[model samples]
Target chain A: MNAISSFTASLPGACAQGLIWGIMALGVFLTFRVLNTSDLTVDGSIATGGAACIMLIRSGVPAWTAALAAACCGMLAGLVTGLLHTRCRIPAILSGILTQLALYSVNLRIMGSKANQPVSVDKYSLMLSQRYVRAAGLSNPIPLLVMIISALIGLAYYFFGTEIGCAVRATGNNRVMARAQGIDTDRATILGLIVANGLVAFSGALLSQYQGFADVNMGRGAIVIGLAAVIIGEVVFGKLLALNFALRMSSVVFGAIVYYIVLQLVLALGLNTNDLKLISAVIVAAFLTLPNMKGGDRDA
Target chain B: MLEMIDVCKTFNPGTVNEKVALDRLSLRLEEGDFVTVIGGNGAGKSTCLNAVAGSFAVDSGKILLGGVDITHMPAHVRAKYLGRVFQDPMMGTAPDMWIEENLALAARRGKKRGLKWSISERERAEYRELLAPLGLGLENRLQTKVGLLSGGQRQALTLVMATLKKPQLLLLDEHTAALDPKTAAVVLELSDRVVQEHSLTTMMVTHNMRDALAHGNRLIMMDEGRVKLDVRGEEKKKLTVRDLLEVFEI
Candidate 1:
């Protein structure tokens, strides 16, 4: 009974964390599902965002400006990866790995060569904080997270409906057709990477504010978590949300929430915290295999 | 409207696998000429069309389109004046996109694509009118994904897209090669109608001798990366598959 109560108490905190990570998953979805490229840069870009945001806040920058600046820094990282892939002729996965590996040193520099840094909500005004997780009215983080997610989804929907966005989609769907139709596919790919990493860093910025600290390893295994959210969203809400792009994105956030809730339940059941990464891997692997199993059934 | 002057291209130069794909190939087209190209494998029929489409830069010589030199233009930049249909049915259209969306993309081929909505109400109506005449029942299924369409249907749609904006030059690189015989015939007929309607300067490459003889006003047979036979007017009208076979010794 004590364990059950504790698990229930952790649900709100888990939901808030899931929502924060959902933004990162949306970034992953842009590359993994939309652009048909698996980008591993999120692992480092997320930490870069956290480190940049915390450092900027410590320097007396406003929290919102710091977050935006962090996102811009993330975009620069994506630009390097894009140039490496398109100009230098590096393979897509390899380019992402290279950028991620390089960002480790860059992230350490951003945090003043320290492994971790903390930002106190009492010392600096944060956009959102864990102290407000269960607070009533406007101070509660859930409503603000929901509002921010809705705005992001709205912006994304509008962007994708535009002509330039259609070109990006075409570039993703068929490069030959896109080029034949006069779209510079290389430019489109670079633009997509820039936008995807910006969102990832923004998520990391909010996460650091919520947790009150930025660590060099904060973003380790981030790509796996993001992929887990994406796969879980597709397998669970694919049928219901497949037709509408906005709904599909919303499903991804819900998938993240479900993942955290499950994690909270497991932890409440006496699971070791260090085994969390193993559990995440298992979950993602299971979900990834589900579609292939269905395909096999059809083949047989 | 189109000219390739002494264009040459070689693959794997300085290597044991060196192969000369285009050897000083020279060709010219009048403003409204419908030229059919036929050749054996490695005879550079498709290579010639690709050269005109700016798929690769030639080692020497210039490509002039509408009296403007475009030898150094990249493929996507040169696409402003060219409409291309590839041999593979899957190569010309985005399978995951809707039919109407594909048409919208084609409509803005040579134009700048800004933040404007991808498909307008006016353009949607125009696309419906354009697709209705195909008799493929595609007009009513504008929202259907292109991947769900058959090979013939996709080829037909690609033909429509290629002609939608009335390009300065239309390139049909064995556009009907992958379809069944009946579908091939249907696509051929559609291609002819669209070409005649627009009076588009076209270069169609085909392996079928009968198709080569039946369709275009001009016929050119390629051999060893150069034009071996150029027939037109009464001479082309009088020529048969037997004459072509005898000339090429196929």
Candidate 2:
């Protein structure tokens, strides 16, 4: 009875976290699956988002406005990485790494060199918070998070159907073909990076608000978690759902939800919280390798 | 419609692998000219085509297209006036996209891409009519991914895409070399029909000596980055395989 109640009590919190992290996972899906680039900038940019949002809110800015600023901060980080890759001729992975390394200091500066900053819910009207996870009233965080995720998905689905969006997809699908068609692949790449990092930062901003504080190390191993969500969503829901872009994206969110609920269960079962990163790494590696180990290596 | 003057290209300068790919080469094409290019390996045949297509900056030269000096234009920007089909079937189309989506992409080549929906009802109807002549049944498979298409089918689709926008110049870099003999013949035929119907200025590179002679009004043989033989009109009509072999032996 005790174990069951504890699990039930923790389920809502885990769901909230999953939904929030699902936004970051959507960003990962954009760069990883859509743009076909393994961007590592999210790790540092998420922290930048958190730092920017909390700092802005602490300075008396509105929460929503602060979230937008955080997303812009993330977009700038992606732009730096994009320019480094395109204009400076650096490889994609290395450019992301360099930008992530540089963002460490930038995030620190944003937080006034402090390792952490707290946004008091009593003093500020945050959009979503842990306090509202089980609240009986309209302040429940799940509905709002779901609404936000749906809105983002709708926007993405619409955008990707547009001319510029098709060009971006073509750029990722085949650079040579894109160039042949007069699509500026460099511009497409930069735009994809900007949009991806913007989502990641936006998630970070929401996460900081949810947790009531932003820590410098909060975004550590974030890419792994995001990937785990993506892979988990794809592997689990892919067979059950119709193969549409929007459904695939929504699966990524569900993947995050499932991931957190499982994490909560593991912790309840006596797994050390500190070893969660190792477990995440192992999970991602296994999931990443499973498809390749099967029959995907054979070419037609 | 196309001119290459004093074009020069050297690969890996200052290295042991340094090779002069194009050495002060020059060529001129009249409007509506369809020229077939032939060469042995290392003859800079593809390099010459790539230079005109702006794949890379020429070491030194001027390339004029339809009275526009495009010597320094970036490859994508230059694509506004040019259509290109590569030897590799995979190089010409986005594999993950649908057939109609790929056509839609090519339809907007060199044109501004905005927030408008990529494919419309009118464009879909146009694509169906355009693809109906190809006889590949692609009109009904508009939503089919290009990756699922055969190499020959892909090349045919690429041909349609290249000419969809009526480019100022069309470049075929051994476009049919990778296809089977039958498929190559069909693509080559389609190439001729499209080029003639559109009155397009075209440059086709071929490894098959007979194909070089068989198609196009003018034929040029490239050797050591220079034009060893250029024949057209009566001189080109009377030429045979023996004469091309003699030139190759030299």
The DockQ for candidate 2, computed on C-alphas, is 0.92
At residue B154, candidate 1 shows an lDDT of 95
lDDT of 2 by residue, B224-250 (tens): 998989998778878888899999999
TM-score of each: 0.97, 0.98
| lDDT accuracy of residue A39 in candidate 1 | 90
TM-score, cand. 1: 0.97
Local distance difference test scores for all models? 0.91, 0.94
Alpha-carbon lDDT of model 1: 0.91
Clash count in backbone of candidate 1: 0
- CAPRI docking class of candidate 1: high
